[model samples]
Target: MLVSSIGASIVQTVGGAVKIHDMSWVTGSGKTMSALLLVPDGASADDKRPAIVLAHGWWNNKQMQDSNYVELARRGYVVLSIDMYGHASSDPLQEGHEMDAATGMYDGVKEIASLPYVDTTRIGISGHSNGARAANFAIPIDDKAATPLISSVYLVDNDPIYTDETGKYVNYYGDRDVGVQADQYDEFFFRSYDANGVALTAPRDYIGTPNAQSFLHFGADPSGQAARKPYTTYTQSVDGRDAVREIDNPAQTHPWGPFSKQEVTSLLTYFDKTLGAPTAIAPGSQIWQLKEGFNALGLVGFGMFLIAFATSLLGTRAFAGLRAGPAPALVPREGRGLLWFWGSLVVSAIVSGVSYWIISANTAVGTVSFLGDPPINPQGAVWIIALWAALNGLVAIVIMTVSYRVVGRRTGVSLRDIGVLPGWRRFWQGILLGAIVVASAFLIVFVLAYFFTTDFRLWVIAIPTFTPNKLAIAGIYLPFFLLYFLANSVAINSFNRFAIRGREWGNTAVLALANGIAPIILVIAQYSHFFITGELISGFGGINSIWLFPIVVILPVAAVVTRKIYRATGNPYIGGFIMACVVTIVSVSNTLTYTR
Candidate 1:
């Protein structure tokens, strides 16, 4: 209760400082777009204010930009954080409309511009990642329109300022003040490439490149190293307005850029320079970090709530029979037994790691691919994960069967001791209980979103409320997830159930590592190599599979939760089902959705 209250309160406090509303409107293309529109107190036609339109990249929604919305609005800028087309709470992308001007950013501009309290000539636009690409696309269209709407633009971790489609670099921003928040370790952009189409240098080396020099000098060649330096503001006059251009390189990865203080400071400084802030606060005076801390607290609270809720339900009369009488015996820690145990774990982890990389590299989910196009755009990534999980689950089944024959039969370990003999009736009841617990948890998610306009999150790991359509999508992926998680539960409860006299938590910590270390290592190795050498390490997997980074968090939590739920119910079904359902919902809802 304390954790839940603190998380909700911090969000409310931040939002209450401004009049925040969850709003949606129909775009020109006949699709609905959603946003959180924040109007500062005293904002009215009598007291007009500068407005800023914000957008998040692929696989994210409006809430992903909450820090910006809260900070900008508190500083007296009317802010509209949008759910980009094909992302959370918005209609799926239609064919031939994949890049609709700005993926709804153009619409966001029109909406904010139409507001009564907004100063028409003082509007700015900003976006991150693919959203930055959308902003890049929107600026030109808005600038060239009969009456231009945007006064300034800021793009984060996007492609080059000028696109070289016809073997000629075309500058899109005609006269709008532009700022680029280029991060040093961005995976996609701002780098010189080698012969095999690999980035030879990191983004920190970007300012010295021909592209950066040309852009910073406004299409002129820089004569000296100082002329191509970063963080220096440049200006040119066009059509009676000063078109300011500046670039700030923060030492961060593409995803990490949005969550950094350095990036936020750059934003504050840029917007203040171009559009001007109503309150002249220092760029370094930031409150977004406080909210972020509370968000992490909320994430912990969410995990605790799930286990607490499940435990409470298992104590009820309907679930009382599901509880087991005694704890299962641990696998022996003596010499040969220990070798077999550690060997199986190492082999399983390696298989899981290798299989995930191979499947992600090979699987392509699209209109023409074997999996075809899913209704939700991110289902392509989901299908890859499902195939990986299903494959691992099969291998786990084989490992467990062989281990039981080789070790368990001789040691007097029964199928019941391994949690595999929960009778069919009890198994069905456990599933029912799991479903009930998950349903209750999501009900809380809905309430939190409705009341506070917030959900439990810290960066890409989020648990947001989903539309009914997501339920149908979750159903399709649940079985594939279950095959892995249920098998995972058996492994954790049976094989790795260590008998530590006073270190129960040590056991959980070991189990968590056992379950998650492979993905953790993959992530660490990928980024570590990139940071050290300025190039991603070779022959890991498809870059698209970087989406699986969340698995590093999910698997460890699942391991811990599986053990906790097993302790409460003395079986694995309830916990496995719950994890599968929750993960499927989160995966299905947080990504892009495509229209068939």
Candidate 2:
């Protein structure tokens, strides 16, 4: 019942002795599915033929497999090409309409295998690009368990194959050696394999000679393309006969379907030799063909070190402008005592030390186990500790700066005349407030995540139970948010000074608009993830989708309301304090509700 003018072509392909039919099947979840089936001429009721199922790649329609279907059909095999979910002629799944390639491939194979003309025992699967990866995922599923049942796999221009627990081939394809002219070809292959822990390798045995030319197309001059050879060079020993016989035509550039007379012949030969007329080759020989490079721990460590070094340099320069300068002489102040600054430094250092100790303990218990060995290299450990200490010292400097400004404000005003007492009360209050705000935000988010989503249970409580990495990630994010709020508050306060015409209202409106707009953009970006991948934004179970827009709108309105209150009372600090309180409450409430 796929009603469309395009259905005419499928009808045309169906005409003659080869009866083409369209049918729907159900998946594991009982979702109805559709596919195009091709049966050869003069097929009998008991006739069984080796069948090949073709899966279309990312953003592609089932018609893309037309050439492949025709070729396979011409070779006397019943061929089926399926339209994946969310693509042409397929039903949409979710809001984003994105389909998982692996799931589609598995189901497609199962549906095709149930066909009357298809020899269930000799099913072969093929896909291009994302479909190629899907075909790889489909081959090992228990046929008795689901749809798109696969027996063997044939990956065209796809790279090496791997075996699943059931020992079926997962063939991959890519450029043997990517060069300037072949840049996009490399990206296409890398995207399919890298995320799944597979690496693209050069076709070592296929390199050199007319059968495996370096140029992408035979008509294109070889000199116009990158100077490097087309195929990867391998030192591993492979049989001479195997090398020459396995080599395919060099004109194709990662094309999945049949492109020309030469390509169709090559594909038929490959399938006939590999899948039809089976051959026995050493497993190790095939494995060697899949690898292009070695994974070295030393190289990885060096790369990380370089990145960390760059980060440190950038962090230092960012805070350099905040360095203290000489105070103006007109202010009669507490004479810039070293003891006051040094005491603040000592307290900050202690707090930072405790935080580091906690983080290190968590890292040791969590990340270390997965890393094989503890990341306790002396040099790296020193750098991490030093950076944390430096950041804490910067915080202390900020506190001292605020104190200096207060001292300047109270210049020449004696304690008795000012009706104030010089004591540790103010100092301790600031310190306690900073700590409470920092700690509360972290605790609130943690509790919310624990109560609300199964994510915490799955990631933390189930697998890698008691991992410190979870704590570290949460801790960093929470404190970072707090710092961002504080910095924003300071900036807004300074900006308010320049307002003259409806100063309070103007300043408040500006701050509210800026804050609201920033978070709105971020929320939109987060939602886009569903269309691209199933992954949501980190933490809070994709709660941003529900709350971000409302909060963005509310915050600005609250800012405006607070500005009016401040103007009526002639107390700007009161306005600022109220704004801060409202924001805090909203944040906490959002976290709690989202988590639940």
Candidate 3:
């Protein structure tokens, strides 16, 4: 009931003042793109409004832009947030589209312009990261036409307007009002390097660099000019067109760029000046944080719902036999026994962490001959994580084998104690229970998204409903993820199941830490180095390792759920299957699926 209320609240916050539609259309290129179109209440062809096309970065979809969508639409600006090709509900990116300059931004702008309720002459385009690249790519293409489609462009955490390939300034935006929300610690863009490829200075000093200087000065030489400042709009007459350009440098990392209030304020202020807001509200007066806060609340409700729903299913006659009592022996909480418990946890963390780095560096995420058809595939980030989980699961089996021989055998810990004694019938029952629980959770998610256009999310971590294609791909990778979760269930519930007589919550907390500590440490170490030294850790498997952030969030929840189910069933199979099914589906659904 609480989860349903949270879902309804999200609906009111997102759609109360504006109507959001899950829409899609084929572009002139014949490729279909998905978008969330937010049209304000009472908007019509007779009451035309300025429109903005918002795009998210790579591996993300239109839902990621909810903050922008709700705020802009509430202020009477028509907003269309699109899922770029190969991401979310959009079609897989087709062949030769990679070489095409504007992947989907041009199409998005054109779509908004065709709307009867939008002012075509005041249409704008904006994107973050690769989305910013798409927006940048579309500007010149639009400008070359006899009647351009866009009047303004905002590039967030991107570096296209500053210079061309050879580090020379170029003004290709063709006099459109432009604003660049450059971040000081952007991992990907806005840097000057020496001839030997070493960075000359930190990213915070970017405003004084030649790129910023020329960009602010309309691509003119800045050798003898006054120091250019950031966040100050400058007007220029270029190619007989009136244009304004500004650069706002936020003290944030690349991923956090869009989430910052300062970035959103910059977006609002720039559009207010360029396309003109129908309702004159202060750019700083914002309510998008309310939207984000509720979205985060939905994430909490989602986790609670999963455990509650699974527990309720276990109470029914169909699944009653799946429940078992606690193991015969608990790992001693004192002396040498305690040492073994802590020692195994440390070992598990190291094995999992090291395996993550090795697999990410060695395994390619795209289609492979060994995984069946390269075209109809479960590709990209899904493959990287599945391979990593399989590797750690193999290591876990070895560790469990040695520990049983060395200590568990004499301690009266049997295979049954560790949850390996389930009969064949019970094993099948566990699978069915897991499937039902996962399907019910997604059904609720789909209903919420279909009605309210919101899903459970906090920043980059999201639990959205998947297409049939993603579900098929999740099946392909399930065994790999299941192996890891099953082993994790045994290890947490048996090997390190420090079941204190009066401290059940503490025990579950410790187990959750043990499950997620390795990935947690990896994320900390990588970003710690990046922030302090201004460089990624050497060969830390590049930026792709950052994907582990979501894993860090997920594994702890999985650990808690595993313990909850273990307490009810006296076995780990049901919880293991549940985690594997949900995580596998999430991994495949939220990433880039390739057509090739």
- Compose the digit string of candidate 1's lDDT tens values, residues 205-240: 887776677777665545563465678789977667
Candidate 3 stretches with Cα past 4 Å from truth are 1-15, 99-101, 164-168, 194-197, 325-331, 334-336, 360-373, 376-378
Task: Report every candidate's CA lDDT.
Answer: 0.79, 0.39, 0.78
Q: What TM-score would every model get versus the actual structure?
A: 0.94, 0.33, 0.93
Evaluated at residue 15, the lDDT of candidate 3 is: 44
What TM-score does candidate 1 reach?
Answer: 0.94
Q: Backbone clashes per model, in order?
A: 2, 12, 3
Q: In model 3, which range of ten residues has the least summed lDDT?
A: 365-374
Report the C-alpha lDDT of model 3 over 1-596, residue by residue, as the tens digit.
Answer: 24543553455345466777889888876888888888887679999999999989877777777667767887889998988877787777754464353877788888888889998988988899888998988877886778888889999988856666787777767678899988887776888888897778666778889888888888877889887788899998977878998999988888886677888888999999999999878888877777677777877877777778878887799987776755454433776666777788788899888877766555443224123234645365677778788888888888888888878787776786567777788878888988898888888888877666677777888887667888777878999999999988878776667666656678789878888898888888887887888766765743455577788889899889888888777777788888898889877777776665
Candidate that scores best on TM-score: 1
Q: How far is each candidate from the true structure, as Cα RMSD in Å?
A: 2.5, 20.4, 2.8
Query: Judged by lDDT against the true structure, how good is candidate 2?
Result: 0.39
